[model samples]
Target: MFFSFWNSVVFIIICLILFIRFDTSDSGANNLHLFDANNAAEMFGNDVFFEILDPEVLRYTYRARPAKDFGVTFNETFYQREALLVPVEPPDSCGWPKNAHEIEGNIALVERGDCSFLSKTIRAQEVGAIAVIIADRRLVVDDDFYIEMIDDKTERTPQIPAAFLLGINGHMIRKTLKELDMRYAVVNIPLNITFVSFHEMNQPPWMIW
Candidate 1:
């Protein structure tokens, strides 16, 4: 029994030493890093912004990505009325809504499935929506959805500001669609929208010690 206990102690000591050695080297914790500016040139010219769509005292900060043709970094604070999710049919998954006329000068709320994000945003833009909000399909996207980078290489970027909304916030706005007629209510059916820019457009999350 004594021999067995001594062997276990030695094994643990060796493990601790190995762990400390590896952790201090390149192959261990030191190798982990944040994903900042993977391709410098590609992301250097782009600008990420924040959108304030809330009317209450608490304003939610939503990251905004500009389309390729969106041009240089600029900030604007404006209000837009949000509308219901449009239905996309077969033959290219392009969406259309019955109230397309109402969306002309308003923001379009589209679900994050059934079609490509660009397709949804393009449809909303074609119908004359100033901005498109792609709601996260999952009830609550645990990670930061805004950190995702938009690839506008092959596919053409949507002209209107295409913003992604996490499930919780997106669903809340979606729920207001049911009360479209209740204009005076706290949340507007076609909710007011705002777009503003900030620094640090391509900073990635840190994943190391």
Candidate 2:
């Protein structure tokens, strides 16, 4: 049940999504609409924090604008690999283990810095990772609090999918390891994305609570 993170968790993000199951015209539509808004309304607020089951740290799930047919219907559970919090050396080099045997066939949770997104992913993939989750280690901007990641922007896209979680969540993961008597965690993450209006998201911050 152990998923490695930076010195990291099994990172099971059980992404709970009930908004799409109910119809907009249905009685629950009013409430379910709010569910939709919470997950997808990054401009107003980013997705809520999810609990990791085993090594137990808060997880952040992310969604991206789908591009045509290539779009993944995040409604399905995706990336169920046992999370391996792969280590990054100082000066920001990923693939610290360097040995593929240690990380083959698992999701590598890597913190963002010291290298291009491609290098981190490509190295992990070369070793044998099923997917990659890039956790931000620093706050570069307000949006850094959200699940965000950028591809290399090359003509070629990775065979695997890579996404980001906020820096706050990353710190939480680290804290859990230091304070708790745990080794790592495993997670199942489901993704949800929907359109949100500025008006719906403009309520007072207290009202959001």
Candidate 3:
């Protein structure tokens, strides 16, 4: 009887340990490196950012500005999503995507122009992109100010998130992918911006200050 009681006790202990470990891992998965508002303002200025979490060599945070009048807005509730950043086939994404199979369940990186911002987002949304990042074709994106992605007066609005990226940053991302022969890059979007100092934040090595 004593031996049976001991066995039951041991089983309970083992179950408890497993449960604790699982809970810890789940919590850790949701936690991300945070940056204070001062850090965010200094580093990205008016832009928000996303982090490249995979291909350790390409791990860096890039600047972006969320659209004002369309799609879901970024907030605590909309944070903590990880997705593959895949470039559209036509780049502009004016028409239906040729690589819809690859774009589905991922974020589409479409070039700005050739269509209204709304149209580009709609095309990506139709193919099941969780979000869209419109990259400017010009070298400078309005001198660090966000170019408003106004409503195109379309009857339907995109249901997913959309943001604008600077041409230089976008070109670098595409160039790096091509050089590495990678089809897509793993990314964590809409990272929570805290009020921590830039020095305390987990800054990528490639970024200068």
Candidate 4:
């Protein structure tokens, strides 16, 4: 009995050591913590990626965190949508966008600020946007960093799905559009990169590894 107990304890200690090593491994670090490949989809709120398809100059993928309480929650297993990524006039989208005509029937890319995330999403929805992607206004050095876009405390609820994109990724996308004198970029939102290996991902050139 004593020998069996000792063996069990030794096995548990080995398992713990292996788990710790795997958790902090180099490959794990590259997968981004919020969407770690080894973790379950529910562990990270079923996070997803936005993949640019048109204007080859900007064909890359970026992470997005979908809202938990409003609209449709993205499913990593099967959810996917292709749409034109249009920028809202006045950018902040605190009020209705002047480019409502352009915003209608496409994904509105609004800058983060001047209003709650839900407010921005609602403004885009009013213009007939199928979905909303609110990009961070301030750029953080960490490429994997992003904000959890939660709903605002109000009776007015948006009916469309929304997600948050990192500031640097947002800036790069907008800058590419400006340089190309374009109004929108064709994109596949919430592209499932859950099982995709880090090296196989079509990550932007600016993204490190």
Candidate 5:
């Protein structure tokens, strides 16, 4: 009789432990939502604004490449230059384990291919990234590419700033760093800006007017 009583007590204890763990996990997730940029800014006196670029907007593109390919022999410059390279995989499997962390404050260097541009930007934003730069894998292709974010089933639309660069551009940027005996350098290019108009209709004025 004593053995059975002890067994019951042990089972009850285990159940209580599991319940507490589950509750804690749920609470943690809830806390994360509260830290979202929009909410955090409001609570902390930080200013946040939305900048929506129509189909056309003036933007710049940058590049990344292997240093060895370029004869450049500088290491200090390269280290000073930091670009958040996004691995070509699911957010959970991306090459940079701290991709989100780095992107929050620095420029995000993302690999082209696999998943939509939107998915990459959204993932970056989750980690606090302010801007995004995508690198193409085709080093030889010299063409302009468009970036689109993946929405999946979620209603949230990614509204982060983003840009794209050719594979060669990336390589050249790396090369420039090496030539200057630097690990990296900032490559800025000017983009053309175009304004778009929104259409709205007004009701006809009443005869009394």
Candidate 6:
């Protein structure tokens, strides 16, 4: 009877050791988190990236035409303005500005060309933009802006809350608001983003070979 008891204790110790190793090694192995449009706000406190699942997160739309075409005469006004604009000659690796730390609280005007929509969002998050607006570099006429999150392996789960906007639409909104002498309205995004864990197997594995 004593020998059997000792054997059970040894088994428990081995199991404990295996559990610790597995848990540490597979940090994000089974860590799949999902969040929707409405509940995204709740995930602000958490460190994990809040994935926005709705197209409505993309609010504004704009045209890719030149500012002069819209009868805006001041060139300096466009450059010095706080509004985000997609560059005509976007960089090969399009990302938020290198000095993006300065624009943390401000909006990120991202150029849409080389990378995926998810990449733009990640870049915006890195720079500390509360929100991101992307403009298409393609210069397609009458193009209504639409951005979609492409599911790719490189798309690491977001560590910050993010959203997408069409480049042209975002530009038009900013321009119109400025022309009307109106302050850019703050949008309160109501999202239902959350993290949850559940049991899959009937019992935890005793050992991993």
TM-score of each candidate? 0.46, 0.52, 0.71, 0.73, 0.37, 0.36
Winner of 3 and 6 under TM-score: 3
What is candidate 4's lDDT per residue for 1-209, written digit by digit as tens?
Answer: 99999999999999999988987796676767656555333343466677888889988887777776776655544344667899888889889788899988888888888888888888888889888888865555464354567667787777788887754777788878989999999988676555666667777877652
In model 3, the Cα lDDT at residue 102 comes to: 96
The sequence of per-residue lDDT tens digits that candidate 5 reaches over residues 66-138 is: 2111122212222322333333222231343353444455445565666655565566656665455555555
Q: After superposition, how far is residue 89 of candidate 1 from its true place, in Å?
A: 12
Between candidates 3 and 4, the one scoring higher on TM-score is 4
Write candidate 2's Cα lDDT for 1-209 as tens digits: 24345223212332222443444357677657656544435543433222254553334332222111211322334535345553322213364554356457765666678777767767667767666556656533356533344555654455665555544555456456557744444655432234544443322221222
Instruction: For candidate 3, list the clashing residue pairs, or say none.
Output: 36-194, 36-195, 36-196, 37-194, 37-195
Order the numbered candidates by TM-score, best leading.
4, 3, 2, 1, 5, 6
- Candidate that would win on TM-score: 4
List where candidate 2 sits over 4 angstroms from the true fold: 1-51, 56-100, 139-148, 153-156, 178-183, 191-209
Better of 3 and 5 by lDDT: 3
The CA lDDT at 45 in model 2 is 43
- Alpha-carbon lDDT, every model: 0.47, 0.47, 0.77, 0.77, 0.41, 0.40
Clashing residue pairs for model 4 = none
Q: Pairs clashing in candidate 1?
A: 80-193, 82-190, 82-191
Return the TM-score for candidate 4, rounded to 2 decimals. 0.73
lDDT of 3 by residue, 66-153 (tens): 8778888656665646679998888899998888999998999988888898899899999999889988765545453547777888
**Candidate 4 residue-pair clash tally:** 0
Q: How many residue pairs clash in each candidate?
A: 3, 15, 5, 0, 18, 16
TM-score of candidate 6 versus the correct structure, residues matched by position = 0.36
Candidate 3 contains a number of clashing pairs equal to 5
